[model samples]
Target: MTKPSRTYRSELRTEQAAATRRRILEAAGACFAESGYGRTTQAAIAARAGVSVESVKAQGPKRDLLLAAFEQAFTGQEGRQPLAEQDQLAAAFAIENDDAFLDTGLEFMAAANRRAYALWRALTSAADSDAEIAPVLDGILARRRKDIESAVGLIQRRGLLAAGVRVRRRVAAELSFLLSPEGYQQLVAESGRSHREYLDWIRSMVRATLERMEP
Candidate 1:
């Protein structure tokens, strides 16, 4: 049997490294969601990933791991790009019909909230005690607010906002609060609303907010 070439060996190593990194990120996300940031240690993450502590350290510190997990959850990948820079958000904005835009937006938000709710709650709980985590949580909220504002802007540009709702910022703020993780947790987790029911509520609220402006 012929041995593999050096290039093949190098490619195999690269694939193995990517797999290791993916495992570490998945393990870290589960750890953070289950244990919160303060209680989740690098050693614990390594154990969860089935890798050595040295390998986890080589990837990055615990903080970087947490941030990477958040990025992965939100953007469906681990990258430094902002949420607005993503094609998903751009596609959402490109939606022309008012009803279609709102439906698509709610669907996307519901999916995201389902994936990240536990992780976000864990981070928010950790933020109260961990100063380092507080800023990261704040940054996440800031980005979410910006995303909501952008959506609201698109709605307004399409003349889909209600006649009485003149202030775009206020409308964005209200929509953001309604679509927030906390709201999702309260309605879905605490109040026991089904995901479809919650999304329907969102649809109703959004439609009520813009009913007068639908052309």
Candidate 2:
């Protein structure tokens, strides 16, 4: 049996979908970058994407929309996949090997800083709880934690981690620290350290912690 070829119009449709999704993400990232989390809205993201508000809504509700935008910006990929690899997750977190831990973690903090704070505030305040965003937010955090595991594994592999670090305990704690939005608000916000400085400390602290636990 012969397989049917994709019609030209069908191919065009696929391309258009790709472009639309990209536009939504780019606009969301730009808006979030400029306005912080509290100010950005679906209408704003739609305008940024050059689409109707309905289109943005159809693309996703608030959680999905934000997740889509952040994932794209962080990983250079579509929404989260089930079995993602370490290097890929690292890329999604915007960390390259060329980036020192501080530099890479700092970039991620900048991208996530406002959004994380805002989303958390929303979770606590509105509806007396987050009706929908909680799971999405949790998923994002889980992924980030996994990225730390990947990074810690790399450190261990290279023997950059100290001689006898306990792998499981260190990875768990480091993940908790890196994934905590409260840490961001306290250190990056109230502590008066610049986001860059705090992130550097996070990297250094995590590395030091992990190295100390090396086995």
Candidate 3:
């Protein structure tokens, strides 16, 4: 049997390292979600990942880990990319029918909320007390506002948005509040609404927001 080449070995090691980092980030997300940032320790994350404490430390400090984990949970990768450019949004935009496009958009938001809500909760709580986290939270919010503007542009192109909605600032602000994680948390987590019920609320509220705008 032939031995693996040096290049092949190098590639394998890189893949293994990436997988380990993913595991550690996932563990970190779980810890932050369950215990909150104040209480979650690297040792706990290491145990959750089934890796050594040294390995967890090798990744980063807890604050860095929290941001990385939140990014991964929310976007399925680093948070470097704009949310609108993601493949999921592209797929949703491909639908030509206005109502169908709106439905797809809502479903996408609902899915994202479901995946990231817990970690988002942790992130917001941490931002309140952690100076380092507050700037990151602000940056994320700014990015989200940009994303909302992008979405509104797409909706305008589809001729679904009213003439009044062409002013992106006002519309984006309304949409941001409508689709906020806090609203999701109150509806689904606090109010005991099922996922479907929460989605229905999103559909109704967002649709109303769009239609009620003066032309």
TM-score for each candidate, following the candidate numbering: 0.84, 0.61, 0.93
What is the C-alpha local distance difference test score of each model? 0.80, 0.62, 0.87
Ranked by lDDT, the better of candidates 1 and 2 is: 1
RMSD of each: 3.0, 5.9, 1.6
Residue lDDT tens for model 2, 1-215: 76556796788888998898888877876776567555679889887788999878778666565556666655565667532342533554444453464355445555555455544443334323445756666766677676556555565655556433466446756656764667777776677888668667677766666556655
| Residue-by-residue lDDT tens digits, candidate 1, 112-207 | 787777778877787788788789878878877777777777777788764334566778888888888888889998899999999999889877
Query: Candidate 2, residue 62: CA error in Å?
Result: 3.3
Best candidate per lDDT, number?
Answer: 3
Candidate 1: lDDT over CA atoms?
Answer: 0.80
TM-score of 1: 0.84
Residue-by-residue lDDT tens digits, candidate 3, 1-215: 99999999999999999999999999999999899999999999999999999999999889899999988887777656888777777788898887888888888888778777889999999999999989989999999999998888777667777644446667888989988878888888888999899889889988887787634
